[model samples]
Target: MEELSPTAERLVSEFVRTTRRQGAVPSRQVADRTLELLRQLVSEPGWRQTAQLVGQLRAAGRQLAAELPTQPAVGTLVCRLLKMAREEHGAHDEVHEARPHGAPPSQVDSLHRRLTAGRGAAPAADLSSELTGLRANLLAGLDELQTELDASADNIAREALSHIHADDVVLTAGRSATVLAFLRRAARERAFHVLVVEGAPFGGGHRAAAELAALPRRVHVTVIAESALFAMMARVNKVILGVHTVLADGGLRAPVGTQALALAARFHSVPVIVCAPSYKLSPQFHRGDQQEGFLESVSPESVLPYADGALVGRARLTCPLFDYVPPELVTLFVTHTGGTSPWYVYRLLNEYYDQQDHEIVQV
Candidate 1:
C-alpha cells in the first residue's frame, strides 16, 4: 500500500489530464509516455526492497486506470514493467545461489551474478547495496524495452508485402498508425487499392484515406461509407485493420465498426489481418466477464446531433467507442514479432506477461 512518489504523482496527473482531453492520442504514444514515467519512478531513490517498488508501481497503475478506464495501454505497460522487475529480481537470486561460495562477483560467468552477488538473507548493512545493483539491472532492462517500443511499428510494417499483393483490394476502417504504416510499406513495392470505410461518429477513415493518398507510392485509395461495407466486401481481397487491445482469448477490442467489417469479410471468404504490436496484447479475457469498465461510450452528439430537438429528446442514443471481434473472425495477426494465428495470442500473452500480475489493476 505504498504511495506514489512526488515525481510519479505529477507525471501520472499530467498524463491523465492530456489523455482525458485528447482522446485521439495514439495507443503507442500513450504507452511510450507511460513507460517513460515508469522509468522515472523506478529511478527515484527510496525503495528498500523489490516488493516496495512493485507496490508503488501498482498504485500508480491503479491511479492511471481509474482516471482513464478506457485506455488499456496504461495498464498493459504497468503490468509489463512489474513483470520485468520480478524477472530481474528472480535472475538476481538465481545467479547469487549458483555462484561459488566466497568467490568474487567478477568470476561468475552469468551477467546477472556479476552484477549483484548477494544472498536474499543478506545483513541489513548490505541490503542497500543489493538493491542498488538490482536497480541498475532494472533500468537497463527498461532501456531495452523502450527501444523495442520505438521499433514495433516498423517491425510490423516490414511484413506488409507478405500479405498485400499487386492489384489486391484492401479494406480497413478508422485510423491506426500501425495499419497506416503497414499499407504504406506495402504500397511502396506493390500496387494495391485501399477501401477505407468512413467510420462515423469519429470519421477516422477519412483521415486514413487522406494519408494513404498522400503516400509516395502507386497506392490507390478510396473512401467508402460504413453502410456500404457489406456490399463492398465481395470485392475486397483482404481486410487489414488495427485494434486497441488483443484479449487473452484471442478476440479483439477494435474500432467500433470492426465487427461488422469482419463479419462481412468472413461471408465473402476474405482474409482478415490485424496489425498490432505485442504491447497491445492483454492478459484479461473479455468473454463472459462482467468487468464494468471493459467497454466505453462517448458523446452521442456525432450520431444524433442535439440541434435536432425532436428526435434527440425522444431517442436514446448510444455510441460505443470499440467493437469486439471474436478470434474466429481474425484470419491472422501481424505483430512486431511477425505473423501469428489468433489462437497463438495466448502464447504471446504468456510470454509477455506474468500470470500473477494479470489483475494488477482490479478496476
Candidate 2:
C-alpha cells in the first residue's frame, strides 16, 4: 500500500472534517477543492516518477472516499486526475520513442480484447529520467480541467434555448444551481412558466421558485406540493432537474422524490432532461445489495419531530436523502460538453476514467 505525503494527509483530513461538519456540500465545490489539492500534490517536491504521484493520489482518494462515503465527486475527480497523469506520461514516452512515419495511430482496444489478452507483469522502466516536463504537462491538464469545471454551468446554459421555448411549461423539483442557470439563461429570450414541486422536509423547490420569480426577466413561477406533481405533469411540456451523481449504468442518484417526478413525466410522455457536469459522472454501479453504503440517511427529526414524543419513540423513521432513477426513466443528460442519451453514459465513463482506476477508492 502506498502512503500519502504529510501535506496531502493534512489536506484530506481537514476536508473530511469540514464536510462532516457541514453536510451536503455541493459536488462542484467538492470537485474544485479536490482539484486544487491534487495540483498542490503534483507541485510538491520529491516525486521522481508518474507512478509515485499516481500512488499518492490513489491513497488520498481512498482516504477521502472512506471518510465521506456519500460524496462521489471526490472519487470521480481523483480518477480523472489519475487518467490525466497517465496520458501526460504516455505522451512524453511516445515523443521519446521512435515509430514509423506512416504507422497508423494506436487503437484503443475493446473490452473483449482486453479480457482475452494474457495477463503478465508490466514492463518496468526507469521513469525518473522520463520525468522531464511531466509536471508541466500535468499542471496544464489540471488547468484545462479547472477551466472546464468553471465553465460547465455556462456551457450547459448556452443550450437552454434549444430545449426550452416560448409558452413551454417547465416542471422541476429541488433547487439545483445548474438547473437555475439553465432556466435563467433561457428566460433572457423566451418567456415560459416554471412549476416547482416543493421538495418536502427541505423545501428546496420553494427556494428555486422564489429565485426564479425574483429574476429580472419575466418567468412565471409556481410552487406546488409534491402531491400535485402527477396532476401537473399532464400540462407540463418538459421536466428538467439536477442530479447528485450519475451512476455508471446510466442511473441517477438524485434528491429524494426525483424518481417519482421522472415517473410522472414518463407517464405524461414528457422529456426528462438532467442538467449535470461531466465531473458528476461516477463510474461506480449502484446495486440493490449495496444499498447499505450507497444510500445515505439523514436526521429523521425533519420527518418525525421530537415534539411528537409518542410517535418518535414507537415509530421508525428513515429519511433517505436521495432516490435512484434507472436509465429507462431518464430521457437525456445535458452535460457541459453537449447532450447525450442515457445509453451513451458508459462511453463517457470510458473517455473520462481509466478502467483500472475505477475502483481505486473502493480499495
Candidate 3:
C-alpha cells in the first residue's frame, strides 16, 4: 500500500490525537479535517495514477479510523472521497475505451505514457493539463463537502419555527450543537422555555444551558438533573435532542442520558425531535448482530474520582459516554434536507454513506 504524503500524515495525526484526547469532538470538525487531508493527498506529487492515489487515500483513511474506531464520520468522509475517485477513474476509462482500435495515441495519452516511462524530467503540457483537471475535480468535491458541513446546522435550524411555538417547553439533554442551533433559531421567532438535563459524569447540560441563554431571543433555560426527566415530562411540549450517529435502522446514539429523556417523553406522549446532519447518518445497523458502536466509554474517574484505591476498587463504575435511543422513541428527525420521520432516516443513510463502506473494519 502507498504511504500517505507528509502533509496528509501530519493533518491526520493531529486530528486523531485531538479527537482521542478531547472526546466528543464535533462530527463536522472531523469531516472537515478528513476532507482537508484528502485534498492534500489528491494534490501530492508522489501518485503515479488515479488508482494509486485512491489506494493511498484508502490506506490513510484506514489509519485515521484505526486511531478512533468509534468515529463513523471519518470513515464516511473517506467513502465520499473514494466515490469521487471512482467516478473520475470510470470517466477516464470510458474515454480510453471509446478510442478506435490500433489508432494513434491521443496527445494526452502520449503524455501519460511518457510520464509513466519517466522519459522526461518534467510532465508534458497535456499531462499537466490532465492532472490539473483531475486535481480540480477532487478539490471541488472536497469543497462541496466542506460547504455541506458548514451549512447543515443552518439548514436544519431553518425548520425550527415549524416545530416550536410560543410558551412551549422544549426539553433536551446534554450539549448538542445541532439542538442548540435549532432552539436558538426557533427562539428568534417564538418565546419558549428550555429544560436541559444535566448529563452527569460530564455535566455537559450546564454548558448547553449557558449557551442557549446567550442567544439574543427571549427564552427561559433550566438545567435539571437526569433523575428529574420524568417529573418534567408533563410540562414539556416537545423534546429536541441531537445525535452522535443515526443508525441505519433509524435508532440514534446520543449523549448518555438521552435514553431516559426519550423514555420519559414517550411516557407522557410528548413528541421527541432529533436534529442531525446527513453526515451523521450511518449505513450500518445497530441490530444485535451488527457492530454500530461509534460510542466510547469515558474514564471511570469522571464518574467517581480517585478518592482512594480502597473505595475505587470496591465500586465498578461503568460510565458509557453515549446511550442508544431506539427509533420508536423518536417522533421526527430534522435534517439538512428538512423534517423527516424516523423511518425515513434509512433514506438519508442511503444518500450519505455508501454500502461498500458500511463496515469500517472492511473500509
The candidate maximizing TM-score is 2
**What digit string (tens of lDDT, one per residue) describes model 1 on residues 208-304?**
9999999877588899998898999999999999898888878988878888899999999999999988778878877543454545778899778
Give residue 209's error in model 2 in angstroms.
Answer: 0.5
Please, what are the lDDT tens digits per residue for candidate 2 over residues 1-363?
A: 368988878877887887788776787888888888788888888577787888888898888878776777788888998888776665567553564455432333244336656875344433344568888888889999999999999999998999999999999998999999999999999999999999998989999999999999869999999999999999999999999889888998888899999988999999999998998898888777356344677888988889999978899888988888999999999999889999999989988987778875431
List per-candidate RMSD values in Å: 6.0, 2.8, 9.1
In the range 1-363, model 3's lDDT, one tens digit per residue, is 447777767777887787778766677777777777677778787776675676677778778767776676787788777767655654565456776677643444445555766554432112111333677788888999889889999999999999999999888888888888888888888898999888886888999999988887658999998777899899999988888877777898777778888888899999999998877776766655234363456688866779777999888877776677889999998888888898887666555544445665221
Task: Give the TM-score ranking, best first.
Answer: 2, 1, 3
lDDT for every model? Answer: 0.81, 0.84, 0.76
Segments of candidate 2 deviating more than 4 angstroms: 94-130, 361-363
Would you estimate the TM-scores of all the predictions?
0.87, 0.91, 0.81
Q: List the residue pairs that clash in candidate 3.
A: none
Error of 3 at 287 (Å): 4.5
